[model samples]
Target: MTVRKATDVFSEWALRDRDEGMEEGHAKSVNDMLKMVIPKFTSPFSVIDVGCGNGWVCRYLESIENCYKAVGVDGSKEMILKAKIKGDGEFHLAQLPFWKPSIKFDLIHSMEFLYYLHDPFEMLKIFYEEWLKPGGILIAGIDHYSENTISLGWPKALNVNMSTFSENEWRKAMLDAGFIDVKIQRVGIKEGFVGTLAMLGQKLN
Candidate 1:
């Protein structure tokens, strides 16, 4: 019997959540990253969102006054289809650790997507080396990190591979990935839930 991959299951789950929109309670954490990130753009910038489920964030980034282009790529074809219909970004269906963009981006963002990789730190290195231009910024928003007890069962429950790294471990990974000034900040705290953590990194020449 052939077994289905965990990513396939996650794709199906995300497709079901497509119509819910980013206004859902769980998405508010990434909204805080958006607040902090959008203002830092001094010039017209291009963005690529990795694992951009439903493309809501891509749509919002495109609406920004200084945004030149916003592109979203996800592994789920259904999610990309829904994003095309309900959101306003160049959405593409691509599997990661292999898909390479035609052009590098000034900003690369991923919300709650990195942990799904078996070795998220290696993916971070790949993103820094291939996806981001020099001086570009990459922010990974994570809710299922080691510190977030609320998400301890996510891997088992979803039957997916999740790398539960500590806050400092994530930082060290970013720094080791040739990113400078790596900083991990917690955002969007709500009662009874661990706040989202933003791993911010910059590629400086």
Candidate 2:
């Protein structure tokens, strides 16, 4: 087994939800994400889920009436392999900010993953140009920076690196990347420790 960071270990635990009866936890989180994202989708549309750990969100979206195809992509090979076995949709393993897809999607989603990027804005711009169709929707779910409780002690203990931004900073970055109609809202609060921030935007014509 590879020496994995705490984040990677957590991601691996997500893959085991099917066996642990933790599907309910996954379902609840997906439901919250969908509730924040799905209103922007009007009709039958294709979706790409970036950093889709074990394809839980992809599978959840597939149950929706208007979601035609749900594709899952992840950087973790183990996660992708598990996703392929558990999900009906296609799963690919690729490093972020470098994936090239011939097909564009009506919606591109990233959850709990952007803060790990060294250059989130650069990646967002690439996603806008390469993955999203004109007038497409982008939904990103992040834990609020103001609420981040991972102190240095915690990071040392967990052996993971995390980066975060305030809601305004995220919105500005999206606008600078040429996204329009951007909106940010707090969707879920868990135990007063972690707060979910859902940012939705539309690609301009």
Candidate 3:
């Protein structure tokens, strides 16, 4: 789908309920997840948040003393606008496949956004080759694929699909993308319904 269509779909979802509390709740969840992943970095770092819906994650990173620079990129203009309104770092409205960073980051992050990509591995490779500095870290958090989630009520006609992978699968993919020391761990558990897995890896010199 085109970026405009994707932006419209996300904007519609964001505007629903018109509840500031919901947004705050989502931000809290994201922050909690990041806390688990960010400490793996040993020192001050430049970070990029891809598909940074509303930019909460980027803003949170900017608030940290060890974060050198925080940048956010999203396909949705409306989401980017919201991120800018939050006010801490730079927000770019650009679709994937056309995104080019002038500088490599010490950390690159994406949460719950990889499943939307048609070529996730290719994107990971690009991040490894072009966007990450030597010894940089890549963290991707995703919902695990299991029988319970396949049955969940999801829209069928949007021409969009989510592909979840097992922990080993993610580790292998990251390895193939030229990362080493790949580690995968589950972060949140929702009884028998859902869970999240965070896959982390480092670029080798």
Candidate 4:
């Protein structure tokens, strides 16, 4: 079976209002990632969520005490429309590795996203080199990795192309992007569900 591009699949999901379910379904794992990483943010921080779907993460980031700016970007127009409809944060349309924001952010976050890219490592490099300020943090989380046996079939089930990667491969990707002090761990596991693989890296200048 041929795999569809991720943006096409997700744009269809937005049209069918499946984006709402996405925010609900991934809330737990995304929240766990937020909790683990939020405390590290300094005051007056700015954030950008790549592949932010409906902008749920952007909304939440805006609510934090010291979060000054929160923005969400996705390749799908429908996904961006849904995020704008919610009216909490800035949302934009962009295809990754080919797009860069005019302003760099203090934190960059992505969930259920990186794996969809044909070249996630190159995207990570863009984040490090263009999208983040010195000392900025990049946290990427995904459920569809090699260890999550359940997610192994997602490519066919969802009909979208997904990169199959191991935990170590992901860690190496971050390190190779020139991010320092890289760390990788699993979060939000539940009975049969293996959990999301969360990775973090910082730009140390």
Question: For this target, which candidate reaches the highest lDDT against the unseen true structure?
Answer: 4
Name the lDDT value of residue 47 in candidate 1.
95
C-alpha RMSD (angstroms) for model 3:
3.1
Each prediction's Cα RMSD?
2.0, 3.3, 3.1, 1.2
Candidate 2 clash pair list:
none
Instruction: Report the poorest 10 consecutive residues by lDDT, candidate 4.
Output: 34-43
What root-mean-square deviation over C-alphas does model 4 reach? 1.2
lDDT of 1 by residue, 1-205 (tens): 3434545875676666833554375467778887777787899999998888778888888888899999999887777887898865698898887688999999998987888777888899999999999999998898898889879997777667778999898988999999998879998788887798898888986
Task: List, residue by residue over 1-205, the lDDT tens digit for candidate 4.
Answer: 7778789889999999999898888888898888877899667899999999989899988889999999999999999988998885789898886788999999999999998989998999999999999999998899999989989999888888889999999998999999999889898788888889999899987
Off by over 4 Å in 1: 1-6, 18-23
Residue-by-residue lDDT tens digits, candidate 2, 1-205:
3334534665666556542344344354556767876886787999998878777788878888999999988877777777788766888888776677679999998777776666887878988888899998898876636455543244345555555577788889899988998887766556644556777888887
Query: For model 1, which pairs clash?
Result: none
lDDT of 2 at 185: 73
Output the lDDT of residue 72, model 2: 86
Q: List residue ranges in candidate 4 displaced over 4 A.
A: none
**Model 3 alpha-carbon miss at residue 46, Å:** 0.9
lDDT of each: 0.83, 0.74, 0.73, 0.90
Model 1's TM-score against the true structure: 0.92
